[model samples]
Target: MEKYVPEKDERAPSAADTTALPTSSNERTPSMILEDLSDSGRPATEEEIKTLRHVTDQIPLRVWLVAIIAAAERFTYWSTQVTWQNYIQYRPDDEIPGILGLGQATAVTVNNAFNVVVYLLPLIIGPIADGKLGRYRTLQICTAFYLAGTCILLGCSTTPAVEAGAALPGFVVALCLTSIGLGGVQTVTTPLIADQYDETVAKIAYRKNGERVVIDRDMTIHYVYSIYYWMANAASLGMILTSLLEKYISFWGAYTLTTGVLLLSVFILWFGKPYFVLCAPSGTVIPRAFRVLWIATTSKFKLDAALPEKQLECGHEVPWDARFVKDIGSGLMAVKVCLAWPILRLCVGITSSNSIAQAGQMQTGGVPNDLLMASNAIALVLIGLVVENGLYPFLEKHRIPFREMARIATGLFFMAVSMAYGMIVQALIYKAPPCYNFPLECQGSDGRIITEPNHINVLVQLPLYILVAVSEVFAFVTGSAYAYKKAPPNMKSVLQSFYASMSGVGYLLAVALGPASKNPGLVVLWGSVTGVMGLTAMDNGQTRKDPVWHGPFAHDVPNSISAFMSQYSALSLIRGLTSRTCTYELKGVNFAYLPLARPHAVENSQPSQKALSPGLSDPASDNVHDRPSGTLDIPEGYISTGNYIPNHNIVPTSALR
Candidate 1:
């Protein structure tokens, strides 16, 4: 109950108080009440700011429910999306109708265009979620559009009107609607999950086995994102089936399977509504944050990181509080890091979109080009586990903290190397090929034109895929956490949108570079990508409020659908659909989605109360609110408002266990 009101006597903490925080467990026992009050808009003293990274918290079980919803969504989106490239580029004259069979150049262009729409839509949708509809409501509306879009596309493939080589207009319409839905779902989902946790305090916690530790907001969020990332990748493994389905069965089957998953996600979200702690949109948070940024940039304001408590005077009067000014500073720092992503992500674009194209050129030993992504997904899952649990903790223990910026730089380096690797692969493919330009027409002994793959092994492409996964581990995964950690709480979704937008920018640039994916330009394309990525390489971050990862597209699917990823993805890359006509291609965003699962403040279920681990105790300050006698049963800092007042019957935090 000791809400942070400045003391009338001392202006700030004394030099002695500013000394390093307690290193031993006995020296630093935090009070849950004090920590809870700190979360309720309490200002940090100078010293607290410096040591913030040292603490982390246990991710609540409720957050996992939200993660599950995102997983289901990833499963559905990928179930059908991994088939975009082949559906557009490969002409099926003998097998089935090649509906709207645009050439490879046109198809990749369309794919880029679709990606641009999906990534950019977040800008529009983010504001709406924060101002008009809340995140939960926004998700519902978006999911409907997503489902409808899939249904329309499904009918396009199944209807009798689509003749062999004929174009389907409904198909384009479906992509548009789904774009909005995808954009809307992505912008709101991550932020919504973040809001579910009680991030008001950090405490000295223990591993389930009694090892002493610190649990704070940053670690808690990082943990949630790690789990969120792993779940999304796990769901992506489903795309293997969808790829086979679209190849062997019908596009209708693939799209239908997707719709079913989408429906499942929607169902989970609706039924579990009561369990969630819905966040009301904070009006115009993004606008205000940007305004602060502008004011800070243009004005004569000087920032001294060592003294955040002493607000510097603004260069211009925009009527913002000191806290708002600090938030703007934080926002700008994040953006500075993010600016590098536009280039770094291009490597991802090349590998995810163009590499799949490259695979199509080389002779496949009966394995699908998109199947290589199974390696990427599996690598990401394992990396996530190893890095977050094994590596990160180990580093922290050794006092060699793994910085986010450094992680991002390393990721960029991986992208550079991967691009270079692809460049080499492309060169070798040309050297060994019968058709030098690939998909080349070779003359048989009888003089009939034979379309055969080059002699290069398809598995040679594994390094590039593995590199992309490794890059994601460092760049994409860490970036998401960094964005969440660095972004102003109110402007979190906006920051995430900023992160997602980089992919769109990269893809747009990729469209311009689409020609590079072709013959002589293949070397130039990969070489240029390598050079650009290496040159612009910088530290960065990604998110739901954190970036989500998506995978590449596949064409045909079997009984299973496909796996689509988000920002570790933009998630639309892997999805391809088979068109008997091969004339049309459906490219969608591959971001994962999950049904919403909120934990209610019920006993023996999930705890809605702020949890404080053992060995933590708050100072019995004079200003602290008096606890009601015998109502010790009430959850700590339980603010009774609306209809309910504190009563003896109220359940305590102990009731959670």
Candidate 2:
């Protein structure tokens, strides 16, 4: 091994460096000590900083196994999910093959309602996984429900069950069970897969190509999620097979194949148990979180007051400690970041249900309307590959920061564009001869109701699906990565579920708008969705100024420090702090968790403020009231102000103002 050797003429360590030393003997290795010793911890030289590149670590085999599990689950899900609209809308005697013979409005309603249930159950199941059952046990139980529900759905699809009047009720029960299964699996699976790689801090490493790079855990997570989503969309191509089976074979055959795929996922989970990283259940987080919130409220919103030492000083006791307070604060920040998701999800709900119905009203050229939904899967796979391999690498090379919030905003913009296109398509479908303003309602010469759809080709819907895919790539994948990165291990499932449940809220809105899925109202429905998404995109762009936009704690530190270090003045102060020893450490700083800049701080700034930094003045003596409303009280240089390690006390300071 190459060894680091300290120079004999190196100066003695400063008191701050000694205080910051790790207690563990293993952590104080010779290499580490020498590594610290050789450091001129003055701000990085401009050339040194400019040449830096962030890249991902090699993904583990165990993580791939988990990803395969997720892919299989998505395969089974979209197979059934995409087919539901056709299954509910048409009759066996009609041109389309279906069971229930419900109208388009009813089909839209049922499909979105199913989406609502699938997303909503995560809230109930997430806590159970986090606090009681643990991820592995919870996944196994949910898979069992998934298998049972699929079996029941297969039985309900049979001709005998339909004649016996048992099909509808059985279908309802199956939907409920399947929803539980899917929601629970989704709540636990995302975080569990991400948990396989636990390294958070970035480090300098050499690639196989012999190029030096920074192995960034955040970038690695970005790559992982991109791969995860790509696999999901690739697996969703199974919808084409299921749609074909439903058309040529039967719904029974379709359900049988999907149920088999689901079984494969279950088997993988069972077999991979030994290799997977399984975390044991950490007892109730939500209840304790509420208690911490109560403590914060009583103490005038100062979260530091919830610390165990603070509680002891006040002659009281609580179930949590200082770390848990930080966890809760981070969780809430994740929640705030996700607030715009519901509107975006509404766009997804429309694409899945109403968009399918819209396709049925256009010329399909003998292809099943449900098959067009597969276009979304195709676009997702293609776009995701290009983005992960092409776009992200380009960004990293150029050091262009395309953070999570920006990605989400880009997604919202795409969603709006997609919905606007859908509205235009609906208008064209309405304008076609024989249908004029009403599709599927025009009468023939004999005054009999005509079933023939409008003259518009179904392929026109491809652009809309392509747009939706772009949105998913930017918005949904980024959201998943954000949740996993920010959440504390114990609260991972809880936070992921809350993020997911927004989809249900969006679908529920679609369900409420069921009546608008048909005729002239289709135009209004698509237009309304377009408007909501557009406004949300604008709002999200503005949120770049918000504290939640700082991103994950790990992401904040190095980037902020590097940017701060680029200044010659900062280098001088760091050198002064080191007493010409050329070393300084930012100790006990918690600006990562603190919302430093107050509202209107950015609006009134000259060019604009860029980052928040820990101010030099002692935090314990600081008063928020003493500072100007839109000003952050930064000192001459950034430094840790006090011995605030355990409690992680906040000093609200903004830099680059």
Candidate 3:
């Protein structure tokens, strides 16, 4: 067995080379030959570059698999939710209100509770996936849980012997399981994509990555969040069909159908596993340190690390200075201010004023109300896509900053208009008599129940969707992007959860306020007030925090403070807020969710001296012993090195000294 050594001048043999030499001891030593090859300088040619580019163009198959799985999971989630209330509310006329209310209440509670888990899971799952099971396996485990939950729901729906109460528990359990799955999927898949490809490749492949490189995990997760939400809605579109199918078939049939889709997702993920690069989990040291630091500041716990060593000045490390803690406290105060301002405005302008107005409209047929509610979802889907992919691009091209405050301002304005639209519809409904003498209702020959006509009321409220849509485009999308960009790298997943948490807070507020006001006029009035406050905040250059005093005592506080703070903070934050620059830049960059099309040209053309062949001999050395040995040993009739010398083709001594 001869030792083999790589040579520098091994000039990659051309296709024309076709001769092989028998191994002999007299040949130059492989080490000497390797030394010669190391000294030889050769630049890569055009062909190599082209070959490299070709390889780089093909994205790994794993990305598509992950995407497909994500899409399927979303579809199943949405399909169930859209009609779950309707399905559960089915009852006789007498039991309708109680059953419907109970179902709605249960669903809402479950949604909120599940969200807590969903939000918190990322905090732990990110570190776990990065350190323990690896991304693919973790996703697989979560998928299994999701599938199990679907099966449980299917069984409960199918078993006639099971009481509704009993079945309800099963449904809750299933929801919990599915929520875990959702969290796991949310935590792992997006980060995995970011890990596999470089910045350039990601940009060309994923629309989100085109403008940014080295994005915070949060930003990457935002794209996943949007995609996941859309998938859920897309699945919901199947609800009508599922409901009809339940009428004709069985409830289990619908669930089973969804399960099948989930299984297909699992299959895709399994097959594509080979293409993903599993990132090793970060050790316990960094994460534990973060946890300690967070606790120390938030709970006033003492730090475990030594004072001098613990104080990290580099923005990347955990800051341990007492001032840093103060800054954090100030930041929290700012957030409190931000959260309170909007609520106060909404309470005064909309909730307090519109209670009776909303009640009056509710007295009319509920079709218009349903339409108004439905319009938000419709607008979210259409307008979100349009603004994110279409409008934002156009704006970016024209150099619009698309700042967070600008978006929040725009969204609040539209939201106010939406409330106003509702108010106008309410007024029309109020003017119409309970039994309008429109001959159209009584003209029917069949003795059918005649309901009040409120066509005018419904028709006028359609523009509310436009307002909601436009607001969502600015508030939700931009807010999400901003959150992810600003979040620290280690906290990417947690940061994404924070974005979800904000929306959760918004939903909670909506639910809380639903019963607070009984007049529609008041609601519209409060909405207008909030809209103005938002606008004032933007104009004054206030950051996210600018408190809006709420509560019964809110009237005591002068608007002057709110106005002054909003203007001053806006200017100060806009001028001095260097912290957000990185985030803003991230929003500009593009990221690819899928793998690169192929291996990059640069990677492939950069010669690995190991791959080259050894030359016949050195030209400068008259001493024959110093001559290089290895030669292009292509056998006659072979395009490549197809077994010219059995298992041991090139003698090790021939390629090196």
The top-ranked prediction according to lDDT is: 2
Clashing residue pair totals per candidate (backbone < 3 A): 101, 0, 65
State every prediction's TM-score relative to the real structure: 0.71, 0.78, 0.53
Global lDDT for candidate 3? 0.44
Which structure is stronger by TM-score: 1 or 3? 1
Tell me the RMSD of model 2 versus the true structure: 11.4
Using lDDT as the yardstick, the better of models 1 and 3 is 1
> Residue-wise lDDT of candidate 2 within 311-429, one digit each (tens)?
99889887777778777666665775577778888889899998888888889998988899999999999998888788767754433445665676677778889999999999999
Best first by lDDT, ranked = 2, 1, 3
Query: Candidate 3, residues 40-135: lDDT per residue as tens digits?
Result: 123334333222211112333454456667668765765554445434433313211112234333433444445456645766665666556766
Sorted on TM-score, best first, the list reads: 2, 1, 3
User: Which portions of model 3 show Cα errors greater than 4 Å?
Assistant: 1-64, 88-117, 120-127, 159-165, 189-197, 200-236, 243-254, 284-378, 403-405, 408-462, 507-657
Writing each residue's lDDT as its tens digit, candidate 1 over 280-306 gives 777876665555544434433433221
Per the 3 Å backbone cut-off, how many clashing residue pairs does candidate 3 have? 65
lDDT of each: 0.60, 0.72, 0.44
